[model samples]
Target: MTPLRPPRSPLGRRFGHLVGAYGLVALTVLLFLAFSLALPDTFPTLDNVSAVLSNHSVPAVLALGVTLPIATGKFDLSIGYGLGLAHVVTMQLIVAEGWLWPVTCLVVLLGGAVAGTVNGLVVAYARIDSFIATLGTGSVMYAFTGWITDGARIVPGPHGLPAAFTDLYDSRFLGLPVPALYVLALTAVLWVLLERLPLGRYLYVIGSNPRAAELVGIPTRRYVVRAFTGSGLVVGIAGVLLAAQQQIGNPSVGMDYLLPAFVGALLGSTAIRPGRANAPGTLVAVTVLAVGLAGIGQLGAQFWVTPLFNGSTLLIAVGLAGYAARRQLQRRRAQPSRPVPEPPGTAS
Candidate 1:
């Protein structure tokens, strides 16, 4: 019997696969060039670069926090409320109770971790759907935030915030804002974890197929819980940075970051390693967003346009991610199967 072979994919199919994989990156570069051309005086300058870096760093960090849960095929909606709670707690400790800044920062970070563990327990052990569980937990966190602030901002006392604390977010290093360095450091850490570590492999396996991961003896529930816990820790750090930047605790500030963070994470799934959420892709997505927003703002767009842009871009990102995932799946399906060997010495 003759060995059967799958037909070669058409040139158009191969080209479409390549485009699906790299289209977002190309789009980002093109957008930057277009903006530079349109606003040559402002968009292409170092000062604008610095401003975008400083302004978007917090959202970028927050987006990374969400990306972890996303990688595990879970959603964490409580990050926004958790961020507000952590920062507000930091302010209350430092300004109201006169606690040391370092101690306050530590306590706030631990609190965020605890909140994350609770979310994990609810989602993993209690068997609640992640979206609903996180939404409920986030609402509770919001209530706690309101209670802490009494619906008011926590302004610093007579001494004001320590210069060292404020400098964490406001200072520059090597001609670039320190926050940008923080983003780079975090991205490196996450990339190593997700791409190079055993723990990361397990998480990816779980995300890709929970049932198969469990059958393979991977601790699906435990790893999912851990993912949420890790996300919480990152959220805590972001909250501390947020406090340092604002120098005040506003209970309502955290929700503003949620949409942008989700936008970056989801948008990122379409680029770099398509069909998966990865650190490099998230960073790229954030850069695209930051540049677009900065260019539009410099163009004197109305206030409502920013939110509208973000919302619309999010929808487009989701659509693109689905398209990319589908393309990848189709490409895999179209690949030829291995050739079967002939019987005994009758091979071709």
Candidate 2:
């Protein structure tokens, strides 16, 4: 019997499969060049690139947080609301109750973890659909934010906060923005966890097939819950960073970030691992969106173009992911099933 093989020559395989995966990256670069050529003096400068990177850091972190739940075929719509509530809680702790910055940050992180635990319990134990569960929870979180803020904004303290705390967003390291460095460090840690650890394997198993994972004695519930907790923790951190950056906390600030964060996650899944939500893919997706939006904005496109671009890219990403999944299934189906060979010396 002949050995089974993948179709397409090596080069063809690389180009065909990887092209869609990296298409957005190439598009980002192309758009950058076009904008640079058109704007000449304004668009392609180092300062502009730095500004884009710094501004995008929080959203990038949120997007990366979303990827873990997504890998397990779940969504956390609560991230935006969670972020709002976290910021509110952090401010209240510091300004109203007179807590120190470190203590307040810890409390906020804990709140996020608790919220995520509720989400995980509903999805994993109650077997509710992730979408509905997160949506309902998200509404509650938003309500909390509004109630806490009294429909108003929370400004910095009288003495403002500690310089060290605010410096998380404001300071520069090695001539690059500090927030960008945070994003890079978080990405590196997560990449190691997702790609090198046993927990990573279990996550992939659960995402691929929960039943199979359970049959193999893996605790799918625990891991799923952990994914949510981790996601929420990261969202909490993002909230803190936002507060520091803006020097104020408004209930409406988080919603604008939601669409772009999801866009980055969806777009990321199409790269790196093609059909998988990997850490590197999520970062690359954010870079592409940041670059594209920066380029478009520099070109004097209408402000609405940013959201329009994100929405369109999200739809295309969904379609591409579906197609890739379907193709994988078809490949599995098309491979010939091996027949049992006749027993040696037992002629019919």
List per-candidate RMSD values in Å.
Answer: 6.8, 6.9
Q: Distance from true position, residue 83, model 1, in Å? A: 1.1
Clashes of 1: 0
After superposition, candidate 2 runs with Cα above 4 Å error? 1-6, 328-348
Model 1: pairs clashing at backbone N, Cα or C within 3 Å: none
**How accurate locally, in lDDT, is each candidate?**
0.87, 0.83
lDDT of 1 by residue, 249-269 (tens): 899999999999999998988
Worst 10 residues of 2 by lDDT: 337-346
- Output the TM-score of candidate 2: 0.90
Counting clashing residue pairs in each candidate, in order, gives 0, 0
